[model samples]
Target: MHSIAFRLVAEEEEGRLMAQRVERRKLRDTINPFELPQSLFEKYYRLNKPGFQYLLDVLTANTEAPKKAFAISPIAKLSACLRFLAEGGYQTGVGKDCDVSNKESCM
Candidate 1:
């Protein structure tokens, strides 16, 4: 009886450890809009650098992530939004181009 009880407790502990384990996610690579040439940047996002900067400044507060680790930058978020608007593609496709995950794109 004692051996059976010990085995059950061990199983319970194993289950708890399994429950606490988090799945590792692959971090997608995001494009840097600033790295693009002026014409390309305008063509992709439909906004000039200055205009994009202005919008970023205006929307930074709302777009900023609370934590830096594993958090997307405000610029990346804005670029994703602009790219979505400019291309008029499905969110997943645009997000893929912008290096955003499908789950984040849905949000």
Candidate 2:
């Protein structure tokens, strides 16, 4: 009985650790361009800080709301677009790099 209890506790601890790891991975996958430093932002998006903000503001201003479920934030969407342009990569490549969907990139 003691052995069984110990095994169960070990399994529970492992599950908790797995959950924490998954959460960390999700946070890492969601790249927040706004949170990046100016130099890294320029390196990735090929725009200066002010220029990026201006374009982001314009894009956000003109952005239409999604008709149904929640959508990716405007900042993330714009960052993906800029990365696509700067990298000159395929939509899927950009999507993978930005953690966006290829269909989202097309839109």
Candidate 3:
């Protein structure tokens, strides 16, 4: 029936939209601290990449696994946290810089 066909088409469209969203996220989350210019890294994180990685290592030395599925990378999480700190500790600002949703950055 036309109704069934229309429902299938709608579902396919939804799936395609979801795939695009996932693709965008995958692209967004590939940010790497080492790739950033040293000046920019220091300005934002208050440390160079080596220093940041050292600090991250010390901080996460005893960390446990996250209680969520598909957790963000440590570097990404640290970068977001540093961005939050640098940008007056604003969740929305950090989210914008990190290409994450405000809710995700807050969490």
lDDT of each: 0.68, 0.69, 0.71
Write model 3 residue lDDT over 17-70, tens digit each, in one string: 999989767755666667666886687777787878897897688788677765
Clashing pairs in 1: none
Candidate 1 local lDDT, residue 98? 35
Query: What lDDT tens digits, residue by residue, belong to model 2 across residues 1-107?
Result: 99999999999999999999876456444656766667766777889878988997788788787665545567766777788898888565444554332223334
10-105 per-residue lDDT for model 1 (tens digits): 999998776654222232333467767798788878899999999999897555455756565677678878888888875644444533333354
lDDT of 3: 0.71
Report how far off residue 37 is in candidate 1 (Å).
0.6
Off by over 4 Å in 1: 1-30, 62-65, 90-107
Give residue 63's lDDT in candidate 3 (0 to 100): 88
- As a TM-score, model 1 comes out at 0.54
Off by over 4 Å in 2: 1-30, 90-107
Please name the candidate that would achieve the greatest lDDT relative to the true structure: 3
Better of 2 and 3 by lDDT: 3
Candidate that would win on TM-score: 3
